[model samples]
Target: MHYLFWCKDNNTSTPQDMCWVSLRMREQHFPGHVLCWVSMRMRDHLFPSPWQRHDALRAEVGAQAGAADTARETSTALYPLIVRQGMDKYKVLEEWRAGSFGATCIVKEAVGDGRRFAVKKVECIDEHEANLALKEAMVLLNLQHPNICAYKEFFITWDNTISSLFLSLVMDVSDQGDLGGIVRLKRQLVKKMDETVIQMLLGQAIDVLVYIHKQKVLHRNLKPSNILLKDEDSFLLSDFVVETLAADEMKLKIRMDDECKLWMAPEALQFSYSEKSDVWSLGCVLLDMMTCSITNDAEVAALLQEIRLDPVCLENVLKTLVGKVGYSADLCQVLLQMLQIHPVQRATAIELMDVPYVKECLILVGSPLSGVKKTLPPGVSDELYEGGIEKALEFMQIYTDFEDAQISALRHLSWYIADQDGWLCIEEIIRLVVQAMKLHSDSLDIQLEGIWILRDLVSQALAHGLNEECFISNELITTLVRGMRSFLPNTGLLSQICSLMMMLSANEVAAELLGKAGVLQDTLKIMESSLENRELCLSCCGLLWSMAMTESHTRREWLVYAVPVIFNLVLKHLHDGQLVESACCSLWILCLKGCVVEEQTESISWALLESLHAHPQRPVLVKNACLALASLLRTSELAAFRVLVPVSGKNGIALIKEIYHLHSDDPEIVENMCLLFSEMAHYGDTRPEMLSQNMGPFMREIKVKFASTEEIVTLAESTLSKLET
Candidate 1:
């Protein structure tokens, strides 16, 4: 076969260069098909006579033909050429650092273009390491994101003298250096970063991870040192070493490298890695950033060392620092999910992006939510409510065909109907909403909307004193419980579900039904999972408080789980007045039922009293704590002594007397105060402490202050009589 090559010149008067090449010679001489043998041969053959006289002209013609052939060959090559400007093109300005792989140096164009770059030189110890370095270069080449370090080019240099090869990767230079340096500098200066800055950096990291994961790559070596700061406001995820996943496998086995163990997930530490492992590393990086801002490098290292000793301690430390660092509740929740010890529970990049805190951060950084927000249809509200039940059903059916529209409409309609009070609780409207929930059982949006609707309906039912049984049935309660379990990790939905459960719990029969349906188990899980979500915790406590009002068996069943969780909540959120009040109220109910264990009684007594001492001005917290203390005392003399012993040092009796004097005009506080003194007077261990204080005038004042209330007057008189005896 014969092939003809044609070339066009900018000068039309110049003849088009044509070359005829034989296929036989082509295959033998150019196995790579990179050079045109005919062009080289023809130039020599045709110009031989004029070569000596026109050496420059002949050389120019050969160069033009070679350039044309190279262009054509490059277009068809299996891999694009590296555009070799050779190692001499870059002048090493400074050695940035040295590592086992090789040295990273600051370099600029040797031609004096003044453009700077980072050149990483990897020494190939063996063929295997060389292949690995080449693979890493390929992985970097495929990545393109603003938050990912940009791969400029790569080249291989051969040294015949040493029989060795070196791979150099050129990347855009980051002016601000790696995140580790920034964190270290900030730590040295004792500079505290705004939560928003931490959030923005985390958001950038997530964005890069999401993009890389979507390309089916795992950044096995994610760490603060691998995150590069492009500028003060920009960060880039760097040094990604790809670990290919088998076609049927979701995880890759990784060798445990001692240097990376600190940031590796539990599973990764065991030589297994997945996208979730990257999330775990990302979480570690986040902690490192936050920790550096608040403390020095030595303390941070010590804290991380402690965490390595006990992985579970990470959660506790994070919880403590979350408050100290003033991180948002949503941000803390995301961090917890990311750091789950079990890889199965750890969040994926996709799920992490959906996290509320992440989304908010993205919005702040001008990355809009993926999809456009759907606007609610006008007149849908009027058609749902005032237009009558049939009109509402007809309007809702229209949205069923469009899921997003349906969810948006349902959410708006539910709130609208809920705002109407009990007037919108007609049978037809209730049935329609229930049917919507059943139809959209698999849709999180619809289910969330259904929860909001049910919440409103139950709230209306409870507020109106309607027969709760008439509105909430066992089947509906079961469905709600299932929804709670399905969306258990969503704190917003969990809060709404807990709110609905609280309303249903107001009814004795409903409360028992919820308990039987494993509502207690689900609520406990929410509490355990959402320790950072104060609203969810408050709602869960309210639900438990209502359930604790049920029969003794049900209350006892709840007390076992509720006590520790509520105790911890009280201890963690001592400054939150509403949370403290709700938690203390639940503890009081448990005590009232005499269901609290000896250990729980002691723990609750100490936590509540400490909280009471911390925030004396919070009237509701104090009242509930006093009532819970009274309940504990009424349970047994041992419980009464336990309550009094801790506060005895600060003149426990004097604090009570002062409380009575401060709020003597308040009926509930006075009543609870009288009850506490009456119980303490009955206990031998506490009676002396009670008598040692200024009790006579305090009792007389209480009795006189509560003269209008029979219960207070009787309790106060009885306490004084006991003192006299």
Candidate 2:
């Protein structure tokens, strides 16, 4: 067959120097409009029919003699190349993209099924690079998300003539072309993509990213061309091999062409990336989708370039998008979140999935691993479901088997439960969440998200005068304990587990359930192992306090060992007022439960007194410290003596006096303060210091100010008699 495929290039006038040799290739290679050179009359005279004006003009046998000469002159056909392995073969149909060392081609199976797939042909420097490429391809193959173009197969071939080696990867193809092509098509028509379309597209993009990132894979090179649109409503995130291929193209320099740099995160340019770097690229892609219709491709690229240099200029693009039809303010705001200049400030893939709109988009038009999402009941879809908590719950229920969807649903639900207030059927939400966690027990991310979301739901229940009875079931408790046992010493996972345990420990039955599941054991182990982690320690302390408050699980033999853990937390984080407050509360309850013996007395006294001196103005810390110190003194005369010993320019008596004066307005503090003094007078050493600090006057003030408060008046009168005598 003879063909005349005419194409033009910007810098060269040579007949053979063209974008590509044919139709789709032209679109794939060229970013600008194709130009025709024939004069109007000559063109019309030569070819009257529209078929003659196609991308390639097929010449009948011997009809156009010059066609053979033209083909020989331009030997740029990258297709028609064959890959044979044993009895199987693949025909390369076209080249989709090309760099110095590699090209991604459209390949037809050329047998049996005769289906099409993409074949990335890479020229490796040696077997080492070839091995690395294969390893990366394997990693990408394992990604296996619905919106990620799956890898079909891979094999290696060598060019014996030049002693060069090639790596070919077979991958699934999308129905539509790449996102860059769609954006370009929209630009030509001058029509912006609708928000629902944007949501669906961006939603799938975020979903793919979340899945890959959780697997510890980073799509360091994310651009429109790499995102393959399946059809109008869906797309596959393609080109996981981009960075590897790009590196091989650059001879291992790890550089991107200026065009690709437009979609790159700024930190990525410096070889720094987290999941957030991919976020920056997704942000750039979002901008391209939103602004492509109104602006030319070059203008959009320039805008992306400008944002990399000046991320604040992202607002300029948002301002333009705000004026464009079919774009929502939420879209604009989310775009801003993605484009944050600092990687820390930028939202991650999972974080983006947490956005409710994005989650809805994921359910509606995003790729689903199994089948469709549960349709909202007609009434709910029309009237009640405005992308609220129910849709989030439904998403989890429908895609319960999909780890990615569950992760996204749980994250979105975590925020929705807080933002939209409470779920009308939170009980159902709880059931689904428990089921998700139990199903995805292997996924640390899912477990963390489920536990975190459940904590928030329980917190909301507490805020609205509800109990843990509804939220905390044996299944939930057992699942939590399993999560604890599954991901031990992961301070983040441990911290969240403890937080939820703390909230549920209020109900005696719930507390006993936790105790039975070995939750208290887990808490003690975490507190011991993670004493330096202030946040985890604080959670452990708080959970221990709640357990002691319930009175049912306090006297367990293992409870006594937690006393020192609380003391160490206090010592380690003396400056952290919240940690100190929570720690003191734990010590107070433990002492009240007889868990704190005389052996732990001095450290407990020191932790309580120093916590008071460290955070005198912290009302909760002071009150808890007073209660803890009063407990210690009531139980041990040695503790009473230890408080009187001055440390950090303040003895226990001075610390108590200062706390009393500073928080005299708080009747709880006054009552706890009186308890401290009465316990202090039990030891003669602490008595003089208490009297010297004029404890009598503070007691009189508490008596007058809180005269109607029975506890405060009784404690104050008793303390005044001891101080005066």
Candidate 3:
């Protein structure tokens, strides 16, 4: 029998690649025959056009026809089948799997729609096998459950050598592959599967079994290979084999292959089986999954042998194993009941569903909040972290009430989501936490947790350049600012609040909202009350720096109140690098807008220069210090002179030269130094000071060295021209 798979080449004008597989059975001298599968790849001539193509071929030809005639005749004969089965609407992408019995190929909608399906082909040697394959397809067609693999439709085709059954199974392409594959892969990662996941898998497996039993059907092949996982939390049962059950005879004899022996029940080996027989196989599957978690396969093999030797002692062994692996005791008991040696003693699927372990597992697996409890694998890559946060957020959206446990869970989950950088800036999560804070205003813990969550989210967002539309909402900003006011006296809470405010102010729209919502005043109050707390003061300084970067009106409002406070903080905390750095950053932004007067600029510049000299190695302080000086120098002539003059026997020119020499490698520092020299050259008095200090030679050298850099070259040229004039 020849099976062909065709895919349209959308990139070309014609279909260039058509794959064919010939499954020829070996000749036998006896009445009964054995099938030996051989797959050979063959490609045919390109079809004329996509519209006029054969979907599939099921011919009973005694002689080979010409390629042109075969194509013409097949297109005409298969056109009705293509339309009836909607085959033209889907094109074969590639073969997923192929074996003696059949093949599975991936097919996608030809209309460029995103829908995909796995199309399985079953080749039957005779009429009996065809009937059995059709019955299996019919059984799958009727079964629909969350844990059961979905079946779309089935069709029949025939050739002189064989009849084939084409079944479309609507299933997600499992990238992680089957349960057995996942177990083996996890073994390599050396990461143990968490018990919560095990319990959840067990519950889901039993749930599907229960459903199938209710419909009076048996999943004869119950093993890890047959169980497919859509994701970490979703497992589906697949590969159903249809068979009859005798009313009086509880057992039906069947061939037991080596693969089947691994999961087949003992009673089934003795040719006596029932629904409880499936329960025994499920026990074996559970054991397989549990043992797979062991990093050493040898240990798993030995453990399995021990359980097989003393079936009744399986409970004790499982208990020890699960306990060592952190599985719950309830699950141990459920496994014990399911693995009972006698068929009558084995727990039925319905009874298994009622088990406490199963119930708890169902709740945890089904609950959206359960994702928060999962222990992510080690080295949790950025992709895994983001996926976890997305899953948690999806789960949180389903529940509204702010119960104590739920609130606490959300608080910790927020920490986890915020623990990593590059969060996708989920606005809904931010709004939900903000609403939680508003609703539970009385709970200080909830408020603090919510505030920290917002702080981390905003920090990551700003760091990763996430959009600011959702964060700048009136309700969120207003709620946060109000929380800041209410939590004023608490130093830790106030620090986080200030930090969050700083990040929010990074966005112009958010800054406008914060300024309008009285965040400026509330922050001032926090600074006033926490004057002695350097952390709080540092955080407030950072917040003010962000606020000063907003529109001119907002910058002016902040400068009016921030200038004096910042100057005092700088003078008071000259020895503290962090406080000095933050204060300098704030002053830089304030002065950039010409918001500082001559006296304030002079005092702030002198203090900053002292801090810069004290902490020459601090890159952040140096960068901010240079920026502040440049801004002050560019403000006005008087402001420039006030800041340029010597203080405490040290000249401002000398200090600027020292900073320039010390951190020449920093681009921002270099750019700002050039700008300061340019600003100084624009003034007549400082122009002589520049010449006296030999600034002309330095400016010429800078101009040549940074010729490729526009900002530096432009500023250097302006300084040299002014100096020469």
Per-residue CA lDDT of model 3 for 339-439, tens digit only, reads 77777778988787666667776566553222223333434322323545555555455443334533544655675774565256467778677666764
lDDT of 2 at 645: 84
lDDT of 2 by residue, 273-342 (tens): 6789888888888888888677886788788878866866888778877875557778888898999888
lDDT score for residue 363 of model 2: 65
Output the lDDT of residue 337, model 2: 91
Which residue pairs come into collision in candidate 3?
A: none
Find the 10 residues in a row with the least total lDDT in model 2. Answer: 33-42
Query: Candidate 3 has what TM-score?
Result: 0.44
Give Cα-based local distance difference scores for all models: 0.64, 0.69, 0.62
- Evaluate candidate 1 by giving its C-alpha RMSD to the native, one decimal: 34.7
> Alpha-carbon error at 199 in model 3, in Å?
49
Model 3, residue 715: distance off in Å is 2.1
Give each prediction's root-mean-square deviation over alpha carbons.
34.7, 28.6, 26.5
Could you tell me the TM-score of candidate 1? Answer: 0.46
| Candidate 1 regions with alpha-carbon error over 4 angstroms | 1-390, 397-405, 418-422, 461-465, 552-555, 646-649
Worst 10 residues of 3 by lDDT: 54-63
